[model samples]
Target: MVNQNNSAQSVEKTPSVDDKNLMNIAQYLKGVQQSHKRSIPPLDQWHPKHCGKMDLTVKANGEWWHEGQLIKRQALLDLFSSVLWKEEGKFYLKTPVEQIEIEVEDEPLLVSQVDQVDIDGKLYLQLTTTNQDVVVVDDQHPIFMRDYAGERRPYVHVRFGINALIQRHVFYHLVELGELDETEQGKAILVLKSGDLLLQLDS
Candidate 1:
């Protein structure tokens, strides 16, 4: 759960760039976090009124920044990440009463680690995100290649329509676990297996 920041004071305003309004929004989000029971809030079910855009930006390297300063609190990052919502190709920090858009330079999240887990003698690849989201690699959380930053990169599906970029070291680890297979067209493809699913790691 995210503790309230010193920036968020109890003052309400119609959504704008005002620092007071931003504070109110953050305060409301903190309240929502305190009241929620699940590890991840049910952002799918939330239909908050559009509260305009915030200056918050998720950088390409997975750092969160608001205004011009870096958001350095891990708890706050976790809190905001819990309520992250993507719709129609846009991303927002959503709560029960309001939704504020945030800029995403690349993918909204990052896969910081990957582990191979054995379940009943079957091996599965599990990915852990920067926000501590653990997701098993399978059809539900498939890994696919996409063009990003002028290069082909592997991205995995996180929850709620959010996808995470596999970090360079993590991708190196994945390459060590994958096998190269040739398609019917005779092109080599690197793939990782999790249970019965085969995930492509290259384009």
Candidate 2:
């Protein structure tokens, strides 16, 4: 996992009423409103054939079909997860942060971020403030989910702050998954059949 050097002390600062007021104003300006544009057709309304089958195979040396085209290894990773592992390794689905113990200076840090699981099981990324206040990043926010179309699918989104900690949790699972592969170049990719596309950790 990469080390994030931001001071843990920053988590101890308290926000003033002025700060709270500004945050409220921001939310008021940005909260979701009824759009004048045409509404998206319901997922159930779509024909079964239009909704692609959920495929979970690891394609290290094989090809995976995407949008009616056969995409090979590197291209598949780029298209799906937007991440390229330096070495061929398995990646696993991460466990929720609430299940782990996170501490700073021997004191347990309050969980300021909440875990969000979409219907499909993909995790959403989130951050928190020092006051133990939760800040749910808008799914439409550029830094949160990228592909809105992908997000519409069945998937889960879990939120957590502290990038390094999140990476640690993810990589820990990756390593565990790596142990299950028979080939050295074989890799595992978490596929969200339906969910948000943005890689928040990259942001």
Candidate 3:
């Protein structure tokens, strides 16, 4: 579940298009957690029929919601993430028998830490997600920027077509590690790396 921080707050909640459908998925999540024993199940192998649309959402700030209420359980989010899959440019969670679609406001994952290395004249970068999964930032998992409401934010590919937003402190660290590289078009790009792991900075 992703609960580094969890507290119940009765603030006004965001409306969901399918709250009833989403709540059922939340209850079903408990079964998945119990049966899988806290590890990720083979969601890719499971091609179950679509149960329905889940009104579950991963907010822009990384908070998760179900049925218009804060989940308040990071563990629950982590559990759902274990079976999370993306197909046809959409996101879904799969249990052994059920598959449910979820809404994601932005990227579902977040970069929580950054590490760098240099070897043999090459640089590489490693990023840690909020889920504690570590992924190397390379050509395969490239880092770039996205525009959200006219503000630019840094993002990196984690895995399975999911991008993790680089947290503020880690972004600052990456900035300090950044250097200028000439592009093929002769334009300069600000980037950081550890070996072949290249992270591009965009304005």
Which candidate ranks first by TM-score, i.e. highest? 1
Per-residue lDDT of candidate 1, residues 121-185 (tens digit): 88999999988889998888999988877988888998888999999899889889998878888
Tens digits of per-residue lDDT, candidate 3, 15-82, equal: 34465344445677675555544565666677788877776898988888876789777766776666
Task: Give lDDT: candidate 2, residue 69.
Answer: 46
Give the Cα lDDT of each candidate: 0.81, 0.27, 0.73
- State the displacement of the C-alpha of residue 56, model 2, in Å, after optimal TM-score superposition: 47
By lDDT, the candidates rank as 1, 3, 2
Q: Itemize residue pairs with steric clashes in candidate 1.
A: none
Query: On residues 1-203, what C-alpha lDDT tens digit does candidate 2 reach at each position?
Result: 11135345345655443333323333432332245322212222222221111223323222333333453544223222211111112221111110111112111112223344454465543433222223333454222112222331111222222211222243334234223323344543332211354332211
Provide the lDDT at 35 for model 2: 50
Off by over 4 Å in 1: 1-18, 32-38, 182-188
In model 1, what lDDT does residue 42 have? 76
Q: Which stretches of candidate 3 lie over 4 Å from their true place?
A: 1-39, 117-123, 180-188
